[model samples]
Target: MPVQVSPERFDEIVGEALDLIPEELAARMENVAVLTADAPSPTQRRGRTGRSLLGLYEGVNLTRRSPVRYSAVMPDRITIFRLSHCRIVRDEDELRRRVARTVAHEIAHHFGISDDRLRELGAY
Candidate 1:
């Protein structure tokens, strides 16, 4: 039988991954909202290839040398797609691993790590 997964279980897995982030790095992140969606929203699907991005990190690049915005709102963040991820993986363990990897990938973006660098680091 195919392995079944629940969003609650996925949320628990994400929590575990969040706990794994380095403390110093985690400190730099604020307002990390761990949202789980079945698929990319229309807005998320806009302006890109029709294929959906598994996770997204919306924040300022750390490498940029500009004054920080005073909007008081830290950059919004880290949304994971549950259904999309599960469809590509075979079992629960694989699903958990993918969740952890995707979490790291988005966190890398928070630290201004480029996608290429993230791939090189095996976070993708």
Candidate 2:
């Protein structure tokens, strides 16, 4: 039976998913931030209307090189939407799985994985 899960439960699940990331993959992740938001931006509109986006990874890809090193690293953000996830997930278990998948999708982008490759790996 599917039990109703709260926001706190989803947060905890996302946390656990973060913990499960392989050390090598997790190590390459630097200054990467994960957050939960209610929705996407005006620029993100592609005809779909929703209160939240399942996840978002906003950061500079490795292909873009910086000539100078700064004192502080730039912020790399990954936003996960709770309500969006809940819409597709029937229970806590599925939600956690989806969260883990979303994390991998964004993290892969950060790690320089191409969109085609990501799709092949089932990250999309």
Candidate 3:
């Protein structure tokens, strides 16, 4: 069954997860915005009706950005889906763990890491 968590609590959990990232990596993140959504949008669903998307990183990745054009670009976005994450966890502790994992996974995408590579690293 899906666990119930208040919106404020869920946001708190997400914040805590972001805090867990290593300082060296976190410090290197530039022009990035980490956000939370209740759930993935229909368009974001991409026809995967039953699958849960824990998080999504949108915008150009670090490695793909041209140095000359990077200065005026908007911040990259990392959105963590609260409802989808909460639905899969058993309790607060599990939610926390999952949030941390999801945050790391999304941040990896920001750094230009592909899902295939993340899976090989056991981070997917």
> Pick by lDDT: which candidate is best?
3
Q: How many clashes in each candidate?
A: 0, 0, 0
Q: Tens digits of per-residue lDDT for model 3 on 9-78? A: 9889989999999999999898999999898887777866657788899888889888787778779899
Residue runs of model 3 more than 4 Å from their true location after superposition? 47-50
Question: Ranking by lDDT, best first?
Answer: 3, 1, 2
Report the C-alpha displacement of residue 2, candidate 1, in angstroms: 6.7
1 against 3, candidate with superior TM-score: 3
- Estimate the TM-score of every prediction: 0.81, 0.77, 0.92
Candidate 2 lDDT over residue span 87-107, tens digit each: 787777787888898877777
Count clashing residue pairs in model 1: 0
The TM-score that candidate 2 achieves is: 0.77
Predict model 1's lDDT versus the native.
0.75
Extract clashing residue pairs from model 2. none
Ranking by TM-score: 3, 1, 2
